[model samples]
Target: SGFLGFVALNSEFPQVNPAGSVLLPLLTGLFGAPVLLISAFSNSSNIPRQERRLAFPSVFAALKGSIAGFFVSIFPGISSGVATVVSSIGERSDRGYIVTMSSANTANAILCFFMLIAAGRTRSGASDALKSLNLVPSFQEIAILSIFSGIVAFLLTIFFGLLIAEKIEKIDGRKLSLSVLVFLTAIVLLLTGLQGLAILLSAIPIGLSTHFLGVRRINCMGCLMVPVMIWYTG
Candidate 1:
């Protein structure tokens, strides 16, 4: 749906203005409707289940995550979403998974700055936006901002972690999922217009297959991966 939305915005095939608003309804219809149905029809499992025993994140986990994140930072078009799936291959524990996810996301952003300095190129939309605004900073400046952002984020996390965590824990899973669907729907509709919605609706089933087949959503990366392979190989 998202890729299709991009196409509708860029291409003149449909003879519509290039706008992201078209993706709104397509996505909302495809994904939102299904989740909404599931949320409404499915009964919550009230029975208590045995908890799976797991260890907290350890030094090895952090190191592994840091390394993986560092590697992902260098790969163009391999977004954090794809990195998460790829990194999950060797990960053993939930804590480890979280560590990888957190590190990948943060490292990707931090590396984008370094990417500007090293490759003299911007690979991310944020970097492009920064370039467009003519606000590109030096490596030293980036380092300082990184430290400041990390400190602030860490402090904020410490301050609000428990309260926010508790509140999130209290939210029903189905309700939360439904809310996400609703939010996506609203965002799609409000931003893309009717055509974007059409594309989104078409893409929903493809996205849902990941869940039904018990596979990682990493395959979604095929959107870029296939074209990339062709671009390089061709």
Candidate 2:
């Protein structure tokens, strides 16, 4: 829905014209509201009484973090991409621009979906843990908190998004910096990407090793502070 909103607000095709921007928020709300409703319904649906007692709150916390992260990552990318494409195509009855951009988005979403499916299959232990943990939001207090938290997060997102939009509107795009810093950073990441991947892969083992040595995760973090600082400085 958010992605659809972005496309509506920033598409280059003038066929939709002024309606596009107006439709963005409306469609976003329409499509997105259902997800919350469905999530609530699904969380509340049939469950064993015993499991429901323990599952609801735990699942709520896990989903809270996961959903927040998912939106944070998705919203910015969609907004940025849409804005870039719109600005590039300009407003001159260019249908191809919007069509091509939308197609790209569709393709990207499909690829990401496939990647997630593949990744899900590989995470057997995590899957098992998830399966063992029931996810019924049964308790009244838990349900209320879940709804409240969602509302707060939604309001916060709107507030911040508007603030950012206002700030960005004041900027003169012609004077904006198009620096090589971004390119350089990308190149650096590309060159060292495999090393970073390896580091992440070894994270669990490294923690286990440290634990065996009677060292804490905090201690490991502290030990890496100097090197991380140097990397950042460079």
Candidate 3:
């Protein structure tokens, strides 16, 4: 939903034209409504009952962070590539810029893949720890927790929306801050993408699976993470 809002604001509003700018608020509102509604539904559905308590939080956090990372990586590359192409065309240059950008993107993609692998390894280690402690939640408990957490998150979003509306007359300044935050966040996400964060993210699902499915965390973690590590390192 946040990404949809960003796109609506950025793409729908023509900065150079008055007529388009005038339509910005209306378009934002129009697009934002359905986006939020869809997001609410999707988020609610993503968590199952069995993994709600032990797995849900980790899964939610990992998925959220992973998504944020994806956007961060994607948008920058897109904007950069677009800019490079525009500049090349304007200068009547060859495909040098395009080639360079492609190479860089490919490298980044490979690095990101490896990072996910490393994160998987880290998750395996965490799972081993869980096994030693013998702490695992039941499926029923997981389901209850998942539903409760989702409700809480939904309520929080509503509350925050109200607070934001009460405080700001317009979203312009807020959008600028959001842009900056996204940029900084992109850097963090990229770093996470490179090392062990990806594995960690996957491990989140493993944790949930273990807790809810009555599987050993160590076994689940090993199944998910070990292959990732092997693939990455090999």
The models' CA-based lDDT, in order, is: 0.62, 0.34, 0.35
Better of 1 and 3 by lDDT: 1
Q: What is the lDDT of residue 57 in candidate 3?
A: 28
Cα misplacement distance, residue 202 of candidate 3 (Å): 22
Supply candidate 2's per-residue lDDT for 42.
54
* Highest lDDT scorer: 1
Candidate 3 matches the true fold with a TM-score of 0.23
Error of 3 at 108 (Å): 28
Each candidate's number of clashing pairs is: 17, 0, 7
Tens digit of per-residue lDDT, candidate 2, span 60-151: 33333333333322322232233224333443333444434443443333333332344432112122223234332224544465468667
Q: Which ranking of candidates, highest lDDT first?
A: 1, 3, 2
Candidate 1 per-residue lDDT over residues 1-234, each given as its tens digit? 345434543544341333333323533453456556456557861223333443456666666556666776686646666556666678877777887778777777888878877886665556754665667899899999999999999778766764565465455667667677778766666555555556666767766676678866566555445444555687
* Reference-based lDDT, residue 135, model 1: 76
- The better candidate by lDDT, 2 or 3, is 3
- Among these predictions, the greatest TM-score belongs to 1
Candidate 3, lDDT over the whole model: 0.35
